[model samples]
Target chain A: MSIILDHVNYTYSSGTAYEIQALKDINIQIEDGQFIGIIGHTGSGKSTLIQHMNGLVKATSGAIYFNGQDIYDEDFDLRNLRTKVGLVFQYPEHQLFETTIFDDVSFGPKNQGLTKDEAGLRAFEALKMVGLDESLYYQSPFDLSGGQKRRVAIAGVLAMRPEMIILDEPTAGLDPKGRDEILDLISKMHDEKNITIVLVSHSMEDVAKYVQRIIVMNDGSVMFDDCPSEVFKHYKELEAAGLAAPQVTYLMHELKERGIDVDTEATTVEEAKRSILKALC
Target chain B: MLRDITLGQYYPADSVIHKLDPRVKLVGTLVYIVSLFLFKGPVGFLVITAFLALSIKLSKVPFLYMVKGLKAIMILMIITALFNLFLTPGETPIFTLGPLKMYPEGVKTAIFMLIRLSYLIVGTSVMTLTTTPNQLTDGLEKGLMPLSVIGVPVHAIAMMMSIALRFIPILIEETDLIMKAQMARGADFETGGIIKKAKNMVPLLVPLFVSAFRRADDLAMAMEARCYTGGKGRTKMKPLKYSGNDARAYLLTFVFLAVVIVLRIYNL
Candidate 1:
C-alpha cells in the first residue's frame, strides 16, 4: 500500500570517465490512493526518481520497497511490479506503433498473459475511460491528432489496471485546452478509481489545481514535501532553485505585501479568489 | 544518464603525432597497415614492431588503451588461428588433436596470424584515438579531393559522413528513451530466444526510425535555409598544411617500409 525510497543514491556510469551522480540520497514515501505532484527543474532527478518506483532503473546504493516488498531482491518479480506501477512518459504518443488504436491500447493487457477476448474487452473499457470516441478505435494511431494520440497511449497504460500510475510531463507540448483535458482526465481517475497518481510536472499552476500533496526536488534531493498550499509558501526558495510557485500563490503574496489583509497561502486560483473576496467584503 | 556514452573514442592530448596534419596520419596509417602485410618473415616483423612501438610512444596514448581495441576482435583472431593451425599442409608433425594433425609450420603460421591481427587492430586504434572525428572527416575530404576529378562528389560524401557521425549519438539517446517507454508498457526485452529478442526490437525500432527521419528532414530544411550549397568554391576556416614533424613522420614511415621490403625479398 506504500512505496518508500530509503536513502537512494544513483550514479550513472560509475567507473567511466563520464561518471555522474543523477540522484543523491533521496528519501520519500508515497501512500496509497493519494494524488501527489512532483515538481522539479530539468535534471533535478525527478525522472530518475520515478523510474525507481517501478524498478526500471535500480538504485546504485539504496533500497526501494514497493508494497512492503524489497524490489532489489534477486527473486523479486519486476515485470509484475511494472504492471502495477504503470508509467507514461513525456511525448507518450511517440510510443504508439500498432496499426489500430485498439490494438495499441491492448498491447499492455496482452502482455499480462490475458486471453485475447479479455484483453480486447479491457482495452475497450480503458479507451472509453480515457474519453476517446469509438469512431477512432480502428484508425492508425499515426493518423490521430496530437492529443488524441496521447489519450490512446494513456489508454494503453490504463488497461493494465495499475494500482499506482506515474506520468512524467504528460501535458507537455500540448495546447492549453489539451493540457487541461489531460489533467482533468487524470484527476477524474484519481477521484473515481481511488488510484494513486504521481504526476511529475514542471507547471506549478497545474499541480496546485489538481494535486493534494506536492514534492519539490532540487539538485537530486527532496527540497520540500507537504500539502500544495504549504509547499507554495516557500516561494522565495523555490524561485532561487530555478522554480516558482503558482501564479495565484505569487499574487496572494503580493497582495499581502501591499498591506492588504489576505491569506497568502492559497495555491490555486479558485482558493485565492475566494480568500481575496472574503477579505474585501 | 544514458547520454554519457563516449563516442568516437577521441582522447585529447598534446604530442607530436596529435599535432601532425590529419591527412598525414591517414596516409601513415595506410602505409603502416600495408607494411604489416608486406613483411613475411621474423626479421621484417621485428623491424615493424619496433617502428610501431616508437610511433605509439610518440602518439602519447597509453599502450594498454590501444591493446584494449584488440578485445573486440579476440574471437575472430582465435577462429582464424584455429583454421590455420589445422588446415595448412606441412612436412613435420608435432601431434594430433581429435583427428586434426598439428605441425610446426601450422603452429608458426597460426601464431604469426594472431600477432598480425593484434597489431592491425592496435595500429588503427592509435590513429582513431589521437584524431577527433571532425579532423578525420576533414582529412578524408581533402585526401579524396583527387577522386573528385573522376566525379566522386567528394564534398557531398564528406557532408554525409559528418552528418551521420553527428546523428549516431542522438539516435542512440532516442533509442534508449523508446526502450524505456516500451518497458513501461510491459514490454520485456531481457528474456527470450534470438528470434523473440529481435521481435522485441520492433517496439524500439519503429519509434527510433520515425525520429531519425524527422531529424534528417529538419536538418535538410535547416541547411537549405542557411544556403548551404555543394563544396564548390568553399573556403576552410583552418586549412591543413604540412609541418616539419609531418615531413619527418613520412620519412620514418617510408624508411620502415623499405626495411620490411628488403628483408622480405632476402627472406631474412
Candidate 2:
C-alpha cells in the first residue's frame, strides 16, 4: 500500500486576519513498511504535513490517496482510514484518561466497534508490543512514570493495529534513558511487525541511526527527500533551513576539509569511525 | 476556527483611553453604566450615547470591532426585547399578532430595553478592551482597597481574577490541541447525543485539568522561589497615581451624571 499526497496545500483560519499558510504545495509518496524520518524546525509544517496523511486535518486544496482511493471521497470511511493509519501526537500522555492502562489503550479499539474481549486482547498485544509490563496494565496511567505513561499512550494507538503509524516528536521531553528506550521499542516494532513508520523528530542523530529515508522540511516545503547519506551531503542547505546533519556527519566533513581523505557522507558515528580508520590505513 | 473567539479580547493601540490609569477607566465605566440606568427618556439616552461615542472614539478601537463583542449577548438582548414587547400592556395599540396585542408603551419599552442592553455591553467592553489584564487587576486591587478595612482579601481576589483571565487563552489552546489529539485516535466528538458528547469530553477534560494543575503548581513554586509573600507590603513598579487627566475624567463623568439627574428631575 502507498500513501500519496497530490499537491497538498493547507491554510489555517483561511478567511480570518490570523490566517497562516501552514503547508505549501507538497507532494510525496510514502510506501508500505518504509521507515521514514521527517525533520524540521518549529512551525516548518512537519506536523501539518503528517496530519494530512490520516485525514485528521483536511488539505485546503489537493487530494490525499490511500492505496489508489481518495480519502476525501464521499463514500470513503474516515473512521476506517484512521484505524488503518494511527497517529501518536506529541505529549501523547495527555490523551490517556481511562481509570486503568488497559482500558485506556483499548479505548481506540472499542471506538472501532470491536467486541470487549477482542478489544482487550488487542490492548494486551499492543501493550506487550510497546514493552509495557502486564502487571502495570491494571494500574492507573496517571500513577506511572513519565516514560511509562507515554508508552501507555502509544499503546492506546497501537491497539488499533494500523498498517502505518506516525509519531510526532515521540521522545521529546524524555530523559536520555527514556528517549533511548522509546526509540528502541519503536525500532523493534518496525523490525518485527514490518509496519510503515513515519517518525517526526528534531534529532538528526536519531534519524541517521534509525530511518531508511529522510525528509527535510523548510518553511512549509520539502527541501530534501532522500536517504540519510545523500541528504546529509547537503549540510549547508540543511543549516540554512534551521537544521543540521548529525554530529558525525559534521565531524567527517571537518576531517575531509583538513585534507584527510574521508567520506563526508558518513552520517552515523560507526560509519564515520570506519571511514576514518580506513583512510588512516 | 475555535481560535477566532474574540469576546472580551483586548485591542492594543496608543490612545488617550489606553494610556489613562486603569483605575480611572474602571471608575469611568462604573459611572457610565450608572448613568445609563439613571436616564428617564430618549433625551437622557441621547446624552449617554454621546458620552459613549466620545469614549469609543478616544479609545481608537474600530467601531465594527466593538460591535462584534455584542454578538455574544445578542440572544439575551432579543429575549428581553421580546418579553417587553408582548407582555407590557397599554391603551395605544401599535399592532396585533395572534392573541398578543402590541401597544405603543410595549414598543417603547422594548426599544428602551434594547438600547439599555446594547449600551451596557459596549460601555463595559470598552473598559476591558482598553486595559491590559495586569493593569485591570492592579486597578481593581487599588479601587477595592477601602474594603480592606472590612477584613476582605482584596489583593488575593484581584490576583485570582488576573490569573484566571491570563489562563483563558492558554487553556483554550490546550483544549483545542487535546481535542485534536483525541480526534486522531478515532474519537468521534460530533454527531453524538448529549451523553455521548460529554463522554467524549472526558479524554479532553482530564488532560486539560491535569495540565492546568501542573501549571498552577509550577507558577506557585516560581512565586514562592521569588519570595512572593501576600500583598501585605508588596509595592508596585507603577503605583496607581491620579493625574490631571484622571481629575478631568472624574469631572466629566460628574457633569454627565448631573445632566442625566437634571433630565429626570425635570421629567425631560
Candidate 3:
C-alpha cells in the first residue's frame, strides 16, 4: 500500500560522452493516502525521480518496492503497476488526441482491457469527478479551453482508478484562477477518493496551501522531508538548495527579526495573518 | 535510445586537425572524396588509405568513434555491394545461387565499391568530427562569399543551416517527452504491425507538429525582438583567418592531391 525507493541511482546516456548523473542515491518512502509535495529547481531530478516510481525509467542501481513487492523483479507486471500509479505529466493537455472527449478520457481504462461499456462508464464517472459538463463529452477535446483540456487529460488518468496519482507541475501554463481551480480539484480528489497524491511543483505557495508534507530535493538527493511548517523553517538551507520559502514565511521571519513575536514557520497567508494579529493583540 | 544517434556530432578536442582552418578541412574533405574515386587499383588504394589514416590520426578522434558512423549507412553499403555482385556481367563465373551467378569481375567491383563508400564516410566524418557546426557554417559562408557576386544569398543560407542544426537536438528531446507522455496514457507504440505502428504515431506526431510550429513562432518573435532583420551587413565576432597550421594543412593537401593525380595518370 506504500512505495519505497531504496538507494536509487540513474545516469542519462551512460557510458557516452554526454553522460549525466541525473539521480544520485535517492532513498524515500511514500505512505498510502499521503499528500506530498516534491519541490526542487530545474535539473534537480524531480521528473526523473517520479518517472522511476512506475518503471518508466529504470534505475542504474538499487530497487523500488510497491507495497512490499519489488517492482523491478523479473516476473513483476510493470503494465499493471502503471495502471495503479497514474502519472499526469507537465502540460498534459499536449498529449490529448481523440475525436471526442469521452473517448479521450476512456483511453486509459480501455487500455487496461475494459469492455467498451465498462470503459465508457468509467470515463463518465471520471469526467464528472473532474467537474466537466456532460455536454462536452461528445465534443472534440481540441475545441475545449486549455484548462478544460487539461481536466480531460487528468480525467483520462482517473478512469484507470489508480490508487496513487502523481502530477508533474500540473498547474503550469494556466491562469491564476485556473491554477487554483485545478489545485482545488486535486485536493478534493485526495480527500474524497482516499488516494495518495504526489505533486511535483516549483510553486511554494500552492504546495504550502494543499500538501500535508514537503520533500525538498537538491542535486539529486532529498534535503528535507517533513510537514510544511517544519520544512519552511529551514528557509536558509532551502534557499541554498535553489528554492525559497513561501513569501509569507519570509514576511513572518522579517516581522520576528524586527522584534515582534511571530511564528516564522507560518507558510500560508492565512497562517501569517493569524500569527501577526495574535502578536499585535 | 533516440539520443544515441550522433549525426553531425562534433567531438571536442584540441589537436592539429582541430586547429586547422575549417575552410581547409571542408575543401580537404572534398579533395579526399575525389581522390577515393580517382583510385584505379590496389596501389592507388594504398595511397588513399595512407592519406585517410594520416588525416584521421591527426584529427585525434578514436578510430572506433569514427568507424561507428559506418553503422548508419551499413544498409546502403550492403545494397550497393549486392547490386554489384549480382548484376555486373563478366567472363568468369565464380559461384551460383538459385539462378544467380557471382562473377570474378563482380567481386572486384563490389570490393571496390565498398572500399570507396567506406573511405568517403570516414574522410567526411573526420572533417565533421573535428569542426564544430558553427565553424563549419562560418567556413561555408566564407567559402561561398564569391557566389554573392553572382547573386547567391550565402549568409541567409548559412544562417538557415545553423538554425536547423540547432533545432535538431531540441526537437529530439521534445519528441522523447511527447512519446513518454503518451506511453503513460497507455498508448503502446511498440508491439504492433507496420500499419498499426504508424497509426499509433498519430498521437506522437500531431502534438510534435503543433509544438514545433509554436516554437518556430516563438523563435521568430525572439529574433525580431533582438532587432534581427536578416543577415544584411552582419559582422562576425570571430572572423576566419588562415594561420600557420592552416598553411601547413594546405601544403599537405596539395601534396596528397598531387600524388592522387599522378597515381591517376599512371592508371594505377
Choose the strongest candidate by DockQ: 1
DockQ of each: 0.58, 0.55, 0.53
Cα lDDT of model 1 by residue, A59-92, tens digit:
9999999889899999999989999999998899
Give the C-alpha miss distance for residue A70 in model 2, angstroms: 4.5
Compute the DockQ of candidate 3: 0.53
TM-score for the B chain of model 2 = 0.91
Candidate 3 scores a chain A TM-score of 0.99
Candidate 3, residue A199: the lDDT equals: 98
Off by over 4 Å in 3: A133-135
Q: Rank the candidates by lDDT, best first.
A: 3, 2, 1
Candidate 1, overall lDDT? 0.89
lDDT of model number 2: 0.90
Which numbered prediction scores highest in TM-score against the true structure? Answer: 3
Fraction of true A-B contacts recovered by candidate 1: 0.65
